[model samples]
Target chain A: MNYRDPQLCELLAGQYVLGTLSARARRRFEGLLPGRPDLRRQVAAWEHRLPEVLGQAPAEEPPAAVWNSLNRRLFAEAATTPASAPRGLFERLGFWRGWAFTSSLLASVFALALLLGRETEIPGYVTTLASMKTRTPMWVVSASPEMDRLYVRALLPMDVPHENGCLLWIKPEGSDQYYLLGSIPEHDGADKMLKIDRKMRPMLKGELYVTVEPVAKGMPEKPAVAPSFAGNWVPIKI
Target chain B: MSSTPEVLGDLLARCALADRAAFEKLYRLSSPQLFGIVLRIVRDRDIAADVLQETYVKIWHRAGDFRADLATPITWMGSIARNQAIDTLRRAEHRITQADDVDEMYDLADDSEGPQDAAARERDAAALHRCLEELQGAQRTAVRLAWFRGMTHEELAEHLDTPLGTVKSWLRRGLLRLKTCLEGA
Candidate 1:
């Protein structure tokens, strides 16, 4: 579509404001709007003309809880979130500083066995999977000493559409390769345990990743979508 | 309505500076209409409340991006509420199932307009209403359903029991006519 064409621009802008454009087309239009003042003006004109349609709907006061929740979200909680766990991953990383904060309280706890001489029954490795940008923790990945079983627990709300499951991946420290660990269950927020073969266990040592993939695809050779969350796994000395 | 655009714009500007008092004032002034807009589409109070909360959070963070010359404060805020509701609707396993009950849920015939509507009716809204009346009956219905229900072309076709192509044409022609009429008004 030639957005520079005045007729097309007006029609697209009208459809965009009317909410009749397809999701992909709407996103494309939005991406184009920032650079095109003519398109921006068209969208603004459409928005200006449409609010009355909104006014036709009679107004009803929301419950007091709505305002309370907003206040808590914008003030009470945001103030305390950074103090407790460093609210955003971008701040910690510094390179990607302006990304939106998606998750919260990303605490990576390492419980190493006190005595290396004794055979420890606890999990051999554990790491919290978090977004690199938001630093908000989403899932906890833990592996048994024998590397036979992996446990994943969702800590935040995840939108997994039907027929799609979260697939876990691992990239060793110096290697560029991403090995598929397996698919974790969707957002039941329940602890999901996946049986892992001996071969895939050692590959889980470095960075952990969780990506949304089609269930039919099984484990792809590489991630089909960008990893939703990522974290580094560090060994704790006893 | 007691809060004029200038006041709301000032409050939004203050909110951009992270003033809590300004945020609260903006919420108190703007949320009712925003909530109404969201609730009309989502049709569930809990979901509407959640979307409204998210909308206000965005407003708080992105308040600085708002340009008063481009859109009214309410329109800018209301667009966020509507977009959030649309996102929720798209992401839900079962899309909001209240298409049949939108009129009842919104009380479309309730003539007790709020002060904001009265104030709006004095200006652009009045022109819009007059222009909307000029659309053909089907065109009017098509535009209203798309606006109020957040129905995409496919969903609108399903809801209206009309063919997809026909619905698309209705929307395109209706919106084009609306644009021309609104511009003239």
Candidate 2:
């Protein structure tokens, strides 16, 4: 049916005023009202008639932030409209300003690297952890004999996904057996310390080795995952 | 006689003439009220802001065509704001299914008024206000549910759990009574 029909126009107008018209119909009505005074009058009449309802409804105060932003936009439009008027939003540098985009990207990359890297340091003992591939120092290890404890820290460059925990491995120099110490605190960019005793007596001169393994939660405690952190523990002779 | 709509009609004409001051004044006066109306319909502050901006842009562009013989300036702008908001709602896939039944609840529908009502309406704001007060409970409900809630006739029917025809009649009759009340006053 043609929206031109008087009845249809009025019905649509009323619904438009009432807001019951579907979005499509409402848009059509707006387009029609400009060209058709009859339709516009019909809508205005409904609006005037409903003053009681609108009046009864409490007025809501909009946020000051909106007003502030609107003022800024209007001022900018007033000031630069001659020069900036031709430029759309993307063309303006202000739209791209600030740290929002770069900050989030940097955060995600850092997390991914920290979670994936495997390496460890044991301070105060002659410990060395090997790279999973080369058995080379993933981290430089140094320890004082007086400390009576081992600290393993990973210094890998890329982020690691650590929704799963990490594993720490230790084997005294000249020993082939790898003893599991425990897991590193996940995703924390701090020195991860592991306890040790001289009774394990594993460290000869520069004999202790520590390796990092990334492990999933609830995995059996028997073995480690990929070796992330490894370094030779060098003793500080006093 | 100058009414609020007539005053706004004049402002819109000035706005059409590229009167930046008039446009600014119009924006200051109308945006908050329109924002509130749009916010109620869209229920999201961000989306409502987007619709509000579009509505004002249309008003600024089309202010010249505004006629006292047609709609009050506020009502015309309201139409733009409401239509944009509803369009947004539709694009978001928020439309209702067939379970709606607006028929049985609003049986007393009518739509007799036309453009001629404008002159008479301008003369009697008080009478219109009174007649609105006199609208039956269902009529008031039907109109409010339609206008503010942005529900369709079928949606209103489903919402009120009434038949489609009745809801339509309630809206029609309610609007007619409201028009008569406004015109008589």
Candidate 3:
């Protein structure tokens, strides 16, 4: 294997990307990569060229659990306190979600609740939190009073502002306060599971909102922005 | 979410700054195609999932290393995925169990798309498809199987039932031609 020969390097690099290189040969090739920009360029060229040969392989979405597993392993800390950046209008809104939100979120919640009222009672309180602006479901939130588990599942990755983070809060029935459940699952952390504090179990019947708040360590005074997505528990008999 | 180079490049720039939102959006938009490619090479859902995780972790960290001057976003990212998948396959080569279930091996492309599918891909993909069509038939399938299955030289020799020497000769010729055709295009 002459590492100096452009022809041999191209052959090895091409097969490496095509994956036909034997393990020993591939290792030898890689050992040569960092020191040899020519080899690296050749390898990158083959890497760029070959996959396109297949044109497009149909996209198969990985099993949903993979995303959750990634969040746990990769972005755990960021979830706890998304980066604390400059405070904007996000930190000023406080726990206030009423009056301003009742018009849209409440109206949709009433409609969905009636839609679910006809179904049998299961143990879980499920809500599909849709964007208030676009009316597209962004997060499917579920709280189980029986199991004391809270799950926030993102339907699609939602974008959080650079200086802000999205948090899940439940406004328990007849209560003026919006209790923080946990950070809402974003594309990075798609399937987040939060434990429903023992005292918060009774609030399962209330409204669910995925709200935007300034990036702060731990819980904030409350969400400073109105609910980006809001819904009520659509009970499922599971 | 579209993966235009500009969009993915912007996402990569943000990811370098530790922007979780951009990283998430990048994963959401790009994972499917990368996963599809990996699932073909690794051939096991569990291992493929593991490989996909490793690939993205590398991407999140390596986003800073990406050179727009070198490759398109998918190519750069796709190469990471294929490298991860192939590495897993080769490292566990002696596992000798699931790897033997050749009957379960996917076709040339896991999800079979036809000529129109080739046309639908971006210019690079389409050009490669055309260049591939020009290769000798044996070399064409040989390279495709090597790519899709991540087969080693010995495995290719055995799988194709050709002599090891002949497979190497033909494969090298095939690869050389592919490079020439692609570069010329």
Best by TM-score: 1
Expressed as tens digits, the lDDT of each residue in B1-185 for candidate 2 is 23255445545654543445556667776677678677766767777787777677667655644555555566678767776777787678554443323333222121222222456655554554567569887777777556555777887788878899998889888876665555556
> What tens-digit string does per-residue lDDT give for candidate 1 at B132-161?
788887787778777887888998888888
Candidate that would win on lDDT? 1
Better of 2 and 3 by lDDT: 3
**Model 3 agreement with the true structure over A125-180: per-residue lDDT tens digits:** 56667654334566665554473876665657666777677888877766778888
Tens-digit lDDT track for model 2 on A1-238? 6977777677677667777766566555666654576776777777655533333122345555555565566556756763232124343222232123234323433443343235422223433343332222333333335545445444343345655555555554455566665565433335555565666434533223333334554534445443444433433332
Candidate 1 ranges beyond 4 A from true positions: A80-238, B93-120, B123-127
* lDDT per model vs. reference: 0.70, 0.55, 0.68
A129 Cα displacement, candidate 2 (Å): 86
Give model 3's docking category.
acceptable
For B55-164, candidate 3 gives per-residue lDDT tens digits of 98878756655766677788888888987888898887622333333323323354343212234454455565678889888887677667767777788788778999
- Candidate 1 vs 3: which has more lDDT: 1
Maximum-DockQ candidate:
3
lDDT of 1 at A231: 57
Give the candidate order by descending DockQ: 3, 1, 2
